[model samples]
Target: MRINVNQTQCGFVMKNGCYEKMIFAGTYHYPACMGYKVIIEEMRGRVGFKEVPLKVLKEDAAFMSRVTMVEVPEGQLGILYINHAASAVVTDREAAYWNVWEPCELRFIDMREPVMDRNVEKNLLRLIAQQYYKKIEILPGEMGLLYQDNILTDELGPGTYYYWLYARDVLCRIVDLKMKELEISGQEILTADRVGIRLNLTATYRIADPKRLVETIKGVENQLYTRIQLIVREYVGRYRLDEILEQKEAISGFLAQRMREEQEQYCVEVQTIGIKDIILPGEIRDIMNTVLIAEKRAQANVITRREEVASTRSLLNTAKLMDENKTLYKLKELECLERICTQVGNISVAGSGTLIQQLRELMGT
Candidate 1:
């Protein structure tokens, strides 16, 4: 039998179903009667010789020289490299590759840590299978809490994180750090005067201590919201409808003070809290509107009376001044005559007395 092996391939000679020798890139001749057979394989990739055992292949110095073996310890992954570039991930206990392609190497990565090295190359990570690790991404304005086996492991800031999923369960919870707005809308409460009102409240807050919040409190937002609702009700119930309407700021200040006192318990910083809207009952609103219109009418009447009194007083003072001065009174008559002439356009003074005396008599002043 004649076998031809190209430069990119190797051959294994088997004699009567048993391994004999390894041959590379050449033509060889053997007698058919000798039961010599050859198996050819491309030597540019992984090494797996099924016809011959690895022990048998390792016995040959030339075969060992042309192959690279990588041993991946338990609970660790092997990153296979060809020519200093990561090509594949080895999850098995051991792997082998042919040296004929390029320089073959392996980088072992320990999987025991919950946090992966930040310096790990993204190209190398792409070679790993998804099932072997869990990925968590925390965006800006968010924080990540990492847990392993239902136990808190570490707090992480905004970034991408990876954990080995083998032999352990992992979970990551994200909490937003930005200011949050909570609205308690359409809340019905009765005032001191038995006036039923619907109130809408807005509260702004931010997480001051996320670690304490998760460790000490469950449903922090709900707890905070309930407290706010109670405080607002308490303050509003103490005042009558009119008093409450006039003292919205007082209610806000009361609620704010109460929230500030309890900030440590909730692990949050209350930015602001206030009543957004105050809706009165239909009957109450109509009554208030009627009262407002009646009060405005009364004010208008008072202003008119005040102006009339001032005009009467001014007329009395002017009459006294004119009665005491004859020349001043005569000047006033002349002014009145000038005004009458401008308005009449054409006038005839047929009276025998002076024009001022006639004008005064005609005007009935």
Candidate 2:
């Protein structure tokens, strides 16, 4: 007598009368039937059966009887009978079989963990069906569906899945979503310490060109960030330290625009590129400040010189006007005399008569 154990076909197998008796007595000691007996007689009363003969029963009878039996062992068993009908059974007395029999279908994309709901398994199955059979069926989950192509099915088949498994999502990023970092140094550019400019630049980018981005960068997300940083460094290199510091807005705008153009091939969107800090060498910054101060001082001197020249010209014009008019001189003498009299309380005008006579002569009296 021969007994075969197969999980796919059935749970357990029973060979002959002797083997059956041995199994029933727990001599076989299989994990599925450890405490139970394999004999028909032992399981008969418990499983609600009268008698099971090897000849009268089909090959599946033993499996069906074992499934109905209350006590068995810990594993899946395939029960074979000579004349009983064929059947399969799980002797494990738990609900673990629920998932085993009804498995969930899932696809992982871009390292993102898929969220599952009550209908995840069902939806996943429906997705699989739609991809292969072109059947439109709604599944659970808030994720939007873009389009289905044979590409996905050709890759992953139907199977049970756990976390962190690799699979593709619906909308493939032209580039990967990642942060890129880069470091650069140049002789012409100012450096914080001495060797190079210490700039902390952060750029956020997503894959815009899936095919090209992947081909060029290997990892589109990280690669794009690095590329943008490189571009920024290059742009900075084109200008002097002062230019970069003074024209930050120009630098930022140029960086954003150039990055967009350069990465267009990858279809990547440069969400943001920030220059966290620009580190200038201490010596260089000090020199720049000194130069600025000197320039301002020079401008002040020019303004002062201009004001002096204007004042001198006004004084010359007043002197020239006084020289051109003798009558004006006579009036000035009288005015001086009156002012002196007011201060001294009395001034006998020996000059006043001569001044009045001169003034009358000048007036053609």
Candidate 3:
């Protein structure tokens, strides 16, 4: 029988004027009025394709050609057509698909439940092959790797390799539920205009169990941020305003330690917690300044009083020592005579050495 091929319609017309569409099956030559009858007989014993409609095959070129005519093997779905150009192959497994014709386009549609796993790497590569340029947001419970373009090659240099790994969206969310409960209690200890004073807190987390994350903590990023804010607020509140304001470094250290302990369940690593600022209330700060000034003034008064008392005691002790020493009395008399001699050129003695003795007798000494 004569058959007319139409690329536009993707169909064939027999000499009897009956039209049959190209389907996903091995080439078959059929007799007039028996369109696709040979192909139907060939697929009769197959499991998945046994009763498959011929019309369905014509619409899906990739599925028709790429899939095996035999039943689909366990653990693998029948190939699905993505593009009409017959370039790409999509599978139900892992929401993954690839473009063998283009050999560059790939895509991983996130139609399945969230999962954190290594399969993300495979899915990412597939997405890149599909030529999708978009940021794949991984929630708190989701973790996976995604390649940008189909640039994954062994010939890539070290710099390019590093870039690919860094570019991958492999973040995870670690929540602090305890901190949230505390916040709801409204018992904040350290109330600052800001949180985590002087501490630089950075968290590094990867999807340890992608499936678990997707199922349990599906939207983790927002939750993690909320937990962090709460944790900082609660822990900071535990300290006094003075501690936060003056001991920022100490506060930061404590926060880092606390965060590490709290975030362990999410398989997160708190790389570092840095204290950045210690915010203080204006009123409390003013009171502290006043108290400090008053304390300094009191200390100065005490020192001044002690010095005055010491000086007076020292003068009185020196006077008592002078009065008790008989040798000091004689020395004083000699000093008086030397002073008189210096003032006058010479001192006249009434009776030689006995002058002072005669004066003492005259004075009834």
**Candidate No. with top lDDT:** 1
lDDT tens digits, residues 1-365, model 3?
A: 43343322123323344333433323345665554332221221121332334454446655445333323333222333334322334452322232323222333334222222344445344423322222344334323333233322222111111122222332322223221211122223434543322333443444344334444565655665566666776777666565566777776677667767866555445545654434335676677799999999999999999999999999888668769996876676667666765898754557665887875654346
Better of 2 and 3 by lDDT: 2
lDDT, candidate 3, at 209: 41
Off by over 4 Å in 3: 1-157, 161-225, 238-251, 265-267, 326-365
Candidate 2 deviant stretches above 4 angstroms:
1-195, 200-221, 238-261, 269-278, 327-365
Tell me, what's the RMSD of every candidate? 4.3, 14.5, 16.4
Q: How good is model 1 by TM-score?
A: 0.80
- Candidate 2, residue 87: the lDDT equals 23
Task: Name the candidate, 1 or 2, with the larger TM-score value.
Answer: 1
lDDT of 2 by residue, 1-365 (tens): 22343332222233442234222222233444443323333222123232454333334444444433223333222232212322223233421111122232212222233332233334333223222122222223211122223122211212322221224334312122344443332223443322356676666565444444433555555556557656765677777665667787777777777887776765677666666677766876788789999999999999999999999999888777778987777786777656765788543436668897875664456
Task: Give the number of the best model, judged by TM-score.
Answer: 1
What lDDT, from 0 to 1, does candidate 3 have?
0.45
Query: So what's the TM-score on candidate 3?
Result: 0.34
TM-score of each: 0.80, 0.38, 0.34
Tally clashing residue pairs in candidate 2: 31
Worst 10 residues of 2 by lDDT: 95-104
lDDT digits (tens) for residues 1-365 of candidate 1: 88889998888888998888889888999666999888898886688678866878888887888999778998899988888888888887866689977888888888877667777777776888888888899999999888889898888898878888878899887888999999888889899999999999999999999877877899988998899888888878889998988999888888888899998889999989899899999999999999999999999999999999999999999999999999889888888877877897776667566876866675666
Error of 2 at 160 (Å): 25
